[model samples]
Target: GALVYQYPRRTICKSGTSMRMECQAVGFQATSVAWYRQSPQKTFELIALSTVNSAIKYEQNFTQEKFPISHPNLSFSSMTVLNAYLEDRGLYLCGAREAGDAEQFFGPGTRLTVL
Candidate 1:
Protein backbone atom coordinates (compact mmCIF):
# COMPACT_ATOMS: atom_id res chain seq x y z
CA GLY A 1 0.00 0.00 0.00
CA ALA A 2 1.22 3.46 -0.91
CA LEU A 3 -0.15 6.78 0.20
CA VAL A 4 1.04 10.36 0.11
CA TYR A 5 -0.03 13.18 2.36
CA GLN A 6 0.60 16.91 2.11
CA TYR A 7 0.31 19.53 4.77
CA PRO A 8 -1.14 23.01 5.34
CA ARG A 9 -3.88 22.12 2.80
CA ARG A 10 -4.08 25.89 2.12
CA THR A 11 -1.94 28.90 2.77
CA ILE A 12 -1.63 32.60 2.05
CA CYS A 13 1.70 34.29 1.59
CA LYS A 14 2.77 37.83 0.90
CA SER A 15 4.55 38.63 -2.31
CA GLY A 16 8.33 38.27 -2.06
CA THR A 17 8.06 36.00 0.95
CA SER A 18 8.32 32.22 1.18
CA MET A 19 6.26 29.19 2.18
CA ARG A 20 7.12 25.65 3.17
CA MET A 21 5.24 22.42 2.59
CA GLU A 22 5.62 18.83 3.63
CA CYS A 23 4.83 15.41 2.19
CA GLN A 24 4.50 12.16 4.06
CA ALA A 25 4.31 8.59 2.97
CA VAL A 26 2.29 5.79 4.50
CA GLY A 27 2.06 2.00 4.20
CA PHE A 28 5.26 1.35 2.22
CA GLN A 29 8.58 2.73 1.17
CA ALA A 30 8.56 5.65 -1.22
CA THR A 31 11.32 5.00 -3.68
CA SER A 32 10.77 8.20 -5.60
CA VAL A 33 8.87 11.38 -4.98
CA ALA A 34 7.85 14.10 -7.40
CA TRP A 35 6.75 17.65 -6.75
CA TYR A 36 4.39 19.50 -9.02
CA ARG A 37 2.69 22.86 -9.25
CA GLN A 38 -0.68 23.20 -10.88
CA SER A 39 -0.96 26.65 -12.39
CA PRO A 40 -4.05 28.81 -12.62
CA GLN A 41 -4.25 27.73 -16.25
CA LYS A 42 -4.84 24.16 -15.07
CA THR A 43 -1.49 22.96 -16.28
CA PHE A 44 0.55 20.68 -14.07
CA GLU A 45 4.19 21.74 -14.03
CA LEU A 46 6.81 19.36 -12.76
CA ILE A 47 9.12 20.83 -10.21
CA ALA A 48 11.43 18.02 -9.20
CA LEU A 49 11.83 14.35 -8.32
CA SER A 50 13.95 12.73 -5.66
CA THR A 51 15.21 9.18 -5.48
CA VAL A 52 17.28 7.62 -2.80
CA ASN A 53 21.05 7.92 -3.42
CA SER A 54 20.46 9.61 -6.76
CA ALA A 55 20.63 13.26 -7.62
CA ILE A 56 17.40 15.19 -7.57
CA LYS A 57 16.05 15.88 -11.02
CA TYR A 58 14.49 19.29 -11.57
CA GLU A 59 12.46 20.17 -14.57
CA GLN A 60 12.92 23.18 -16.84
CA ASN A 61 12.11 26.60 -15.40
CA PHE A 62 12.46 25.05 -11.94
CA THR A 63 15.68 25.39 -10.04
CA GLN A 64 16.97 24.83 -6.56
CA GLU A 65 17.25 28.59 -6.26
CA LYS A 66 13.57 29.15 -6.70
CA PHE A 67 12.36 25.82 -5.29
CA PRO A 68 14.46 23.81 -2.90
CA ILE A 69 13.71 20.22 -1.94
CA SER A 70 14.67 17.79 0.75
CA HIS A 71 14.17 14.03 0.81
CA PRO A 72 15.20 13.00 4.26
CA ASN A 73 14.05 9.39 3.98
CA LEU A 74 12.02 6.94 1.99
CA SER A 75 8.75 8.07 3.52
CA PHE A 76 9.04 11.82 3.78
CA SER A 77 9.98 14.90 1.77
CA SER A 78 9.66 18.64 1.86
CA MET A 79 9.92 21.60 -0.47
CA THR A 80 9.95 25.34 -0.16
CA VAL A 81 9.39 28.16 -2.57
CA LEU A 82 11.76 30.97 -1.76
CA ASN A 83 9.70 33.80 -3.17
CA ALA A 84 6.02 34.39 -3.42
CA TYR A 85 4.61 36.04 -6.52
CA LEU A 86 1.42 36.15 -8.50
CA GLU A 87 2.69 33.53 -10.89
CA ASP A 88 3.95 31.37 -8.06
CA ARG A 89 0.54 30.86 -6.65
CA GLY A 90 -0.86 27.44 -7.33
CA LEU A 91 -1.65 24.00 -5.93
CA TYR A 92 1.52 22.26 -4.82
CA LEU A 93 1.22 18.51 -5.04
CA CYS A 94 3.50 15.69 -3.97
CA GLY A 95 3.37 12.27 -5.53
CA ALA A 96 5.18 9.28 -4.13
CA ARG A 97 5.97 6.32 -6.29
CA GLU A 98 6.42 3.23 -4.23
CA ALA A 99 9.06 0.62 -4.83
CA GLY A 100 8.42 -1.51 -7.90
CA ASP A 101 5.24 0.36 -8.69
CA ALA A 102 4.41 2.10 -11.91
CA GLU A 103 1.89 4.53 -10.45
CA GLN A 104 2.60 7.46 -8.18
CA PHE A 105 0.22 8.17 -5.33
CA PHE A 106 -0.60 11.83 -4.84
CA GLY A 107 -1.35 13.90 -1.80
CA PRO A 108 -4.24 16.33 -1.40
CA GLY A 109 -1.93 19.26 -2.28
CA THR A 110 -1.23 22.62 -0.75
CA ARG A 111 -3.12 25.51 -2.26
CA LEU A 112 -1.20 28.75 -2.15
CA THR A 113 -2.50 32.27 -2.41
CA VAL A 114 -0.26 35.25 -2.97
CA LEU A 115 -1.38 38.60 -1.70
Candidate 2:
Protein backbone atom coordinates (compact mmCIF):
# COMPACT_ATOMS: atom_id res chain seq x y z
CA GLY A 1 0.00 0.00 0.00
CA ALA A 2 1.30 3.39 -0.97
CA LEU A 3 0.38 6.58 0.81
CA VAL A 4 1.29 10.21 0.23
CA TYR A 5 1.29 12.79 2.97
CA GLN A 6 1.11 16.46 2.04
CA TYR A 7 1.81 19.23 4.49
CA PRO A 8 0.21 22.58 5.19
CA ARG A 9 -3.25 21.31 4.30
CA ARG A 10 -4.47 24.86 3.90
CA THR A 11 -2.72 28.20 3.63
CA ILE A 12 -3.30 31.80 2.75
CA CYS A 13 -0.76 34.20 1.37
CA LYS A 14 -0.87 37.72 0.09
CA SER A 15 -0.61 38.32 -3.58
CA GLY A 16 2.87 38.19 -5.14
CA THR A 17 4.21 35.74 -2.57
CA SER A 18 5.39 32.15 -2.81
CA MET A 19 4.37 29.00 -0.97
CA ARG A 20 6.08 25.63 -0.72
CA MET A 21 4.50 22.26 -0.09
CA GLU A 22 6.00 18.88 0.63
CA CYS A 23 4.97 15.34 -0.12
CA GLN A 24 6.17 12.10 1.43
CA ALA A 25 5.53 8.61 0.16
CA VAL A 26 5.17 5.75 2.59
CA GLY A 27 4.75 1.96 2.35
CA PHE A 28 6.37 1.82 -1.07
CA GLN A 29 9.10 3.23 -3.22
CA ALA A 30 7.88 6.16 -5.26
CA THR A 31 9.38 5.99 -8.69
CA SER A 32 7.48 9.03 -9.85
CA VAL A 33 5.70 11.99 -8.32
CA ALA A 34 3.03 14.01 -10.10
CA TRP A 35 1.85 17.45 -9.04
CA TYR A 36 -1.65 18.58 -9.90
CA ARG A 37 -3.82 21.57 -9.24
CA GLN A 38 -7.59 21.38 -8.88
CA SER A 39 -8.90 24.84 -9.38
CA PRO A 40 -12.40 25.79 -8.48
CA GLN A 41 -15.00 24.47 -10.87
CA LYS A 42 -12.35 23.02 -13.07
CA THR A 43 -10.92 19.55 -13.46
CA PHE A 44 -7.52 18.64 -12.19
CA GLU A 45 -4.64 19.95 -14.23
CA LEU A 46 -1.36 18.12 -14.47
CA ILE A 47 1.23 20.53 -13.20
CA ALA A 48 4.33 18.39 -13.41
CA LEU A 49 5.81 14.97 -12.96
CA SER A 50 9.17 14.12 -11.47
CA THR A 51 10.81 10.79 -11.96
CA VAL A 52 13.76 9.42 -10.11
CA ASN A 53 17.04 9.96 -11.94
CA SER A 54 15.18 11.61 -14.78
CA ALA A 55 14.26 15.14 -15.66
CA ILE A 56 11.18 16.77 -14.23
CA LYS A 57 8.44 17.15 -16.80
CA TYR A 58 6.16 20.16 -16.73
CA GLU A 59 2.84 20.28 -18.45
CA GLN A 60 1.67 23.05 -20.72
CA ASN A 61 1.17 26.41 -18.98
CA PHE A 62 3.47 25.25 -16.19
CA THR A 63 7.19 25.72 -16.02
CA GLN A 64 10.16 25.33 -13.76
CA GLU A 65 10.32 29.08 -13.58
CA LYS A 66 6.98 29.33 -11.85
CA PHE A 67 6.48 25.92 -10.27
CA PRO A 68 9.81 24.45 -9.39
CA ILE A 69 9.91 20.82 -8.38
CA SER A 70 12.36 18.77 -6.37
CA HIS A 71 12.46 15.02 -6.24
CA PRO A 72 15.59 14.13 -4.36
CA ASN A 73 14.84 10.47 -3.76
CA LEU A 74 12.36 7.69 -4.21
CA SER A 75 10.06 8.70 -1.43
CA PHE A 76 10.08 12.45 -1.25
CA SER A 77 9.08 15.39 -3.43
CA SER A 78 8.34 19.08 -3.10
CA MET A 79 7.11 21.99 -5.15
CA THR A 80 6.68 25.69 -4.78
CA VAL A 81 4.09 28.01 -6.23
CA LEU A 82 6.08 31.09 -6.98
CA ASN A 83 4.62 34.56 -6.75
CA ALA A 84 1.20 33.36 -5.87
CA TYR A 85 -1.80 35.14 -7.26
CA LEU A 86 -5.56 34.83 -7.63
CA GLU A 87 -5.23 32.57 -10.63
CA ASP A 88 -3.04 30.22 -8.57
CA ARG A 89 -5.65 29.57 -5.96
CA GLY A 90 -6.49 25.89 -5.95
CA LEU A 91 -6.06 22.53 -4.27
CA TYR A 92 -2.55 21.39 -4.95
CA LEU A 93 -2.26 17.62 -4.92
CA CYS A 94 0.63 15.18 -4.92
CA GLY A 95 0.37 11.76 -6.47
CA ALA A 96 3.17 9.29 -5.89
CA ARG A 97 3.53 6.14 -7.92
CA GLU A 98 5.80 3.15 -7.58
CA ALA A 99 7.40 1.21 -10.38
CA GLY A 100 4.85 -0.84 -12.31
CA ASP A 101 1.99 0.62 -10.33
CA ALA A 102 -1.07 1.31 -12.41
CA GLU A 103 -2.31 4.17 -10.29
CA GLN A 104 -0.76 6.82 -8.11
CA PHE A 105 -1.42 7.37 -4.41
CA PHE A 106 -2.66 10.88 -3.83
CA GLY A 107 -2.36 13.05 -0.78
CA PRO A 108 -5.14 15.11 0.72
CA GLY A 109 -3.68 18.16 -0.97
CA THR A 110 -2.71 21.66 0.12
CA ARG A 111 -5.29 24.31 -0.54
CA LEU A 112 -4.02 27.69 -1.59
CA THR A 113 -5.74 31.00 -0.95
CA VAL A 114 -4.55 34.24 -2.43
CA LEU A 115 -5.73 37.67 -1.48
Candidate 3:
Protein backbone atom coordinates (compact mmCIF):
# COMPACT_ATOMS: atom_id res chain seq x y z
CA GLY A 1 0.00 0.00 0.00
CA ALA A 2 1.22 3.50 -0.78
CA LEU A 3 1.08 6.15 1.95
CA VAL A 4 2.31 9.62 2.67
CA TYR A 5 3.04 10.87 6.15
CA GLN A 6 3.42 14.39 7.43
CA TYR A 7 4.62 15.48 10.84
CA PRO A 8 3.29 17.97 13.38
CA ARG A 9 -0.38 17.71 12.48
CA ARG A 10 -0.85 21.18 13.93
CA THR A 11 1.45 24.17 14.28
CA ILE A 12 1.10 27.70 15.60
CA CYS A 13 3.56 30.40 14.62
CA LYS A 14 3.98 34.12 15.04
CA SER A 15 2.88 36.29 12.19
CA GLY A 16 6.37 37.10 11.02
CA THR A 17 7.94 33.70 11.63
CA SER A 18 8.40 30.65 9.45
CA MET A 19 7.69 26.93 9.66
CA ARG A 20 9.22 23.83 8.13
CA MET A 21 7.50 20.47 7.71
CA GLU A 22 8.30 17.06 6.32
CA CYS A 23 6.67 14.39 4.15
CA GLN A 24 7.49 10.72 3.87
CA ALA A 25 6.37 8.15 1.34
CA VAL A 26 5.90 4.59 2.45
CA GLY A 27 5.26 1.21 0.77
CA PHE A 28 5.97 2.56 -2.68
CA GLN A 29 8.25 4.78 -4.68
CA ALA A 30 7.06 8.36 -4.59
CA THR A 31 8.22 9.66 -7.92
CA SER A 32 6.39 12.90 -7.48
CA VAL A 33 5.13 14.91 -4.49
CA ALA A 34 2.49 17.54 -4.99
CA TRP A 35 1.95 20.15 -2.31
CA TYR A 36 -1.42 21.79 -1.81
CA ARG A 37 -2.99 24.20 0.66
CA GLN A 38 -6.54 23.94 1.99
CA SER A 39 -7.90 27.01 3.63
CA PRO A 40 -10.29 27.32 6.53
CA GLN A 41 -12.83 28.54 4.05
CA LYS A 42 -12.42 25.31 2.14
CA THR A 43 -10.59 26.78 -0.81
CA PHE A 44 -7.80 24.66 -2.27
CA GLU A 45 -4.70 25.67 -4.11
CA LEU A 46 -1.99 23.68 -5.83
CA ILE A 47 1.34 24.88 -4.58
CA ALA A 48 3.91 22.81 -6.40
CA LEU A 49 4.83 19.45 -7.86
CA SER A 50 8.25 17.98 -7.26
CA THR A 51 9.18 15.10 -9.50
CA VAL A 52 12.33 13.10 -9.22
CA ASN A 53 14.68 13.48 -12.18
CA SER A 54 12.63 16.41 -13.41
CA ALA A 55 12.37 20.11 -12.78
CA ILE A 56 9.94 21.14 -10.03
CA LYS A 57 6.84 22.89 -11.28
CA TYR A 58 5.09 25.49 -9.12
CA GLU A 59 1.61 26.78 -9.63
CA GLN A 60 0.98 30.37 -10.74
CA ASN A 61 0.11 31.78 -7.31
CA PHE A 62 3.04 29.94 -5.72
CA THR A 63 6.76 30.33 -6.20
CA GLN A 64 9.89 28.50 -5.17
CA GLU A 65 10.91 31.61 -3.26
CA LYS A 66 7.88 31.31 -0.99
CA PHE A 67 7.37 27.57 -0.85
CA PRO A 68 10.64 25.80 -1.50
CA ILE A 69 10.43 22.02 -1.96
CA SER A 70 13.05 19.34 -1.62
CA HIS A 71 12.87 15.85 -3.08
CA PRO A 72 15.89 14.01 -1.82
CA ASN A 73 14.96 10.64 -3.27
CA LEU A 74 12.06 8.47 -4.41
CA SER A 75 10.61 7.93 -0.94
CA PHE A 76 10.78 11.32 0.79
CA SER A 77 10.15 14.99 0.27
CA SER A 78 9.74 18.24 2.25
CA MET A 79 8.79 21.88 1.94
CA THR A 80 8.93 25.08 3.94
CA VAL A 81 6.71 28.11 4.28
CA LEU A 82 8.87 31.15 4.86
CA ASN A 83 7.95 34.38 6.61
CA ALA A 84 4.59 33.11 7.65
CA TYR A 85 1.65 35.44 7.52
CA LEU A 86 -2.10 35.32 7.99
CA GLU A 87 -2.54 34.26 4.39
CA ASP A 88 -0.17 31.38 4.97
CA ARG A 89 -2.47 29.81 7.52
CA GLY A 90 -4.04 26.65 6.18
CA LEU A 91 -3.80 22.88 5.91
CA TYR A 92 -0.76 21.90 3.92
CA LEU A 93 -0.91 18.52 2.25
CA CYS A 94 1.61 16.29 0.52
CA GLY A 95 0.35 14.05 -2.27
CA ALA A 96 2.65 11.26 -3.38
CA ARG A 97 2.37 9.49 -6.70
CA GLU A 98 4.19 6.67 -8.38
CA ALA A 99 5.02 6.37 -12.09
CA GLY A 100 1.79 4.93 -13.45
CA ASP A 101 -0.89 6.54 -11.32
CA ALA A 102 -2.74 9.63 -12.40
CA GLU A 103 -4.13 10.11 -8.89
CA GLN A 104 -2.03 10.90 -5.84
CA PHE A 105 -2.20 9.53 -2.32
CA PHE A 106 -2.34 12.43 0.12
CA GLY A 107 -1.00 12.74 3.62
CA PRO A 108 -3.16 13.89 6.50
CA GLY A 109 -1.37 17.23 6.31
CA THR A 110 -0.02 19.85 8.69
CA ARG A 111 -2.45 22.44 9.95
CA LEU A 112 -0.75 25.82 10.10
CA THR A 113 -1.88 28.65 12.34
CA VAL A 114 -0.46 32.14 12.02
CA LEU A 115 -0.98 34.80 14.64
Question: TM-score winner among the candidates?
Answer: 2
Give candidate 1 misplaced runs (Cα > 4 Å): none
Full-model lDDT for every candidate: 0.91, 0.94, 0.91
Model 2: residues with Cα > 4 Å off, grouped in runs: none
Give the better candidate number (2 or 3) by lDDT: 2
- Candidate 1: clashing pairs of residues: none
Cα lDDT tens digits, model 3, 1-115, are 8778998799999998889989999998899889999998887699998899898999998999989899989988989999999999999999998874666899999999999
| Model 2 worst lDDT run, 10 consecutive residues | 96-105
Candidate 2 lDDT over 1-115, as tens digits, reads 7789999899999999999999999998889999999999999999998999999999999999999999999889999999999999999999998864558899999999999
**In model 3, which runs have C-alpha deviations exceeding 4 angstroms?**
none
**Per-candidate TM vs. native?**
0.94, 0.96, 0.95
Clash count for candidate 2 is: 0
Candidate 1 weakest ten by summed lDDT: 95-104
Worst 10 residues of 3 by lDDT: 95-104
Clashing pairs in 2: none
